[model samples]
Target: MDNMKQLIKQFSALITLSLILTGCVSLPEPIYLTDEEVSIAAKVGITEQQYRVIKTSQLYQLSPRQTDQYLRILHEQEPDLRKRIGRIAEKNIGQPYELYLLGEAPFEPYDSQPLFELSKSDCVVFVEHTYAMGLTDNWGDFFKTLQHIRYNNGEVGVVTRNHFTEYDWNRNNNWLVEDISSIAGENTIKTYEQTINKERFFAKQFGINVPQDNVKTVETYVPNEHIPAVAQYLQTGDFVNLVRSTGKGAWVGHVGIIKVEDNGKVNVIHSASPAVRKEGLLEMAKSFLAETPERFAEGRTATVGFKVLRLHETANDNLKAKFDGNVPPIMMLNRKYEYLTKEQVKTKLALMREQAKKDLIENALEQSKQSDIK
Candidate 1:
């Protein structure tokens, strides 16, 4: 009996060892910097510890802890928010492109996706994460800011999420950026209005019910042929929405950030199906217009124009004020919580989401009552 018990214990130990060796199990381990890594860290003017953490993760050479530290470094090195945004995004140039990368996971049962993803990103996730990271120096603040950018009034749910590009995302984030598509020059622009039925969109895409109908009225864009003229006005860190034409209707199909070169050239950096990459604005426009019928058959849409947004001059200062406990309750949590464990965060966020939903519904009811009284 004793030998049999010992044999079982040995077997269990071996199985656990195998799982750990094969990367099936994760355990926190101390990070040790090698001599070469230490040298490189010194050469780069960062501590060996910081470099070690940065190298541990493949996502833009930054682990979560490294991101917090690096953000501070970036802020110190570059005071200009627009240039900083471009620089931060450039670090993730080779990140793998993915679709539907984020959802409210562990916080709510609506979507099984996690709160954040570092290694891979879709166009929207890439833009949101980059902007969030650019604006904050820690994981907690980044997470909060990302939610603020992603959802209307910073509510966490499928119903409140900014699913539509022009109607929801652009409108909600107007404080951070301004739609300057019309300012790209009158001759270089086109205008169109898109009706967005969020009621149908939520039902079809997410299997959720939302009692809302929305519209993107009178959106201006610069057509692909006029990109050269439009590109002249584009500055670094400008938001770009790629407009796709289906011959029936149009939508902002993809999103990217504009990077202006020292040599006076404009570039669009985006994450597409294969991976993240940078392309000159004029060349990208030409390529889009040059798509073959075979490419279209393979599920590629023609990018007909671009809706551009410029960063607000006071965006960084405004964000800082919010971070400093001067935020409105509707826009943020109104108070900062210290670093929280995953489980604690999950519980708190779940409650917050429920509260936000209730608040929204009550506010709508109150508005309806006022209208009836009038």
Candidate 2:
């Protein structure tokens, strides 16, 4: 009996050891790039000009921590700015643009201001302050600030909402032309035209590449029930093949450049506002088709479109250098001097593993106790 008990104890120990070893081996090793690797990776398949644009762009060479900090700061300030504009607009119940311009109004339009005056150092900042806050009906005061800015200097860019229509054109065009003579008004039309022209000029000056004309429309070319393929493509970051669903049928949606990372994260950096975002490929398909899972399984179709855009890389060498040394490029770019080192990453991973093991053991013990009670 004593020998048997000792043998049982040894067996239990072996099982525990095996489970621990398996868990350790199953975890993926964190990959770190050397400075050289980072540079090389950035330059791969990109033109010299494109690379230069990327280097100068705000999105370049940002470390994860720096990105997080930038996002946090924006999130913090947005609410206050909105509140200030809201209060000012509320004070002036009914007022015309002229009233505000003549200092007869309490609110100032900030959206109409130049990019420099708006302090839009980052692309995300511009999107958040302009489109996200501008078009909302209740955000009139906040919008006034934007208008004031534009009226004082000049509109930076024009963002068309989800649709493109004559009404959309009329909004800014009448002002640009300074044609208040006609029903549509020449001034408004001219202002809109001027805004568009200025936007184009600035885009060229900054080397910002707008989306292709054909790519703007919805064109679907795939089967309705192809969720697996869509999910797979999204996971793999193959932006060239997107599934689109129109009212008529389902097809490949506009194929565009897609960048993906681990943790099921995906983002498309293009002409769209809110440049960086989390969009589920599957969710988009469902919404586009207006179909349930059952309908998709039953071959219900929808219309969608796909367009592919080539990306150019800039600061590839600099990015590579930082990564090669296990330094986070985003941190350097954002000037967040202190970032996680390889040692720190390894330590965190180990700590997480240890906690997981403890939890598992506790759960198993509880289960065993319940089984014995049964």
Candidate 3:
């Protein structure tokens, strides 16, 4: 009887252990975004061109090999569009312009087509109409209209008249230029002059800014020539954004900026890379930013940096005090004014860094827990 009791107790203990092990084994595994996720991120909108690509490639029903081929073709075609637009810009560099189409291309069908392809004629008409109304829609035409323009020479004009009412010429170009020039030195024009300076241009072009600091700063193991000048604007506690270029050629393929974090590990906030939505540091850096380990190392070696400027106050203040405010008061000062105190910026940076560290740890633990369950 005693032996039997002991045997029964042992059996119970074994069963309990087995149950626990089974429970552990049954836990769910964490899911990470795959190449599909990255591909989804790359999608900008349901443009007509995208629809055409999708339908032509039969991506929805494609085999793995076919899908891969389709993606390759899409990537190859992206630069061709840019080249065509740049050719157009170059040809019309000095002309007082109106929108022109290469020829009468049929308007893409509305249902399956992307809205961007409403009509090539419509796009040209929009540009011409805006120009006539005294509004310059240069960036819109350049960046948005990719289909009608060919790879060869095409010309478009800048609006010279001030009589139009539909577009706000003063608000669009003159006011911002005057305002930025007033705050920044006159040389700002030579350095940062581009179509991107337009407010609508940047806002429409990019997505929402994350809740954290508009900018982030990071230190790389390698020497980056672009850092010192930008660093002057950063405070020790302030977060600074970062962007690094990726691609085999001279062009930058991928760009993202670092968000604030407490741990030494960098946290990035970006859209449409290896993953579509916003992600934490490890996933983002490991997946999208550093897709190729060799390329990542090479980028680290080159060390191009970035910082976001979400709010205009600090940037504007820095520009005013450093470049605009004091004339001849401080001779031998660097042409780029250094006015903000390090402490003011540092406080914000420290908070951001701490938040980042916590986020990373949470992400790791979650991943581990999920794996254990699986």
RMSD of 3: 28.5
Q: Which ten contiguous residues of candidate 1 have the minimum total lDDT? A: 328-337
- Tens digit of per-residue lDDT, candidate 3, span 178-212: 22211222222112111111222212222211122
What ranges in model 2 sit over 4 Å off?
A: 1-113, 116-259, 263-277, 292-310, 314-374
lDDT tens readout by residue for model 2, 1-374: 99999999999988878877988435445455446434543545333444333333343233333323323323333344333222222222221111111111112221243322221123222222332232222333334333422322222233322112122322232222111112222221111111123223223332332332212222223332344344343422222334433233333323222445456544432222323233555555456545544445666543342322221122123223434733221110111112344565456446656865896699899999999999
lDDT of predicted model 1: 0.77
lDDT-based ranking: 1, 2, 3
What candidate 3 gets wrong by more than 4 Å, as runs, is 1-224, 228-257, 263-267, 276-308, 312-374
Best by lDDT: 1
Model 1: pairs clashing at backbone N, Cα or C within 3 Å: none
Error in Å for residue 129 of model 2: 11
For candidate 2, what is the total of clashing residue pairs? 74
**Candidate order by TM-score, highest to lowest?**
1, 2, 3
Error of 1 at 371 (Å): 34
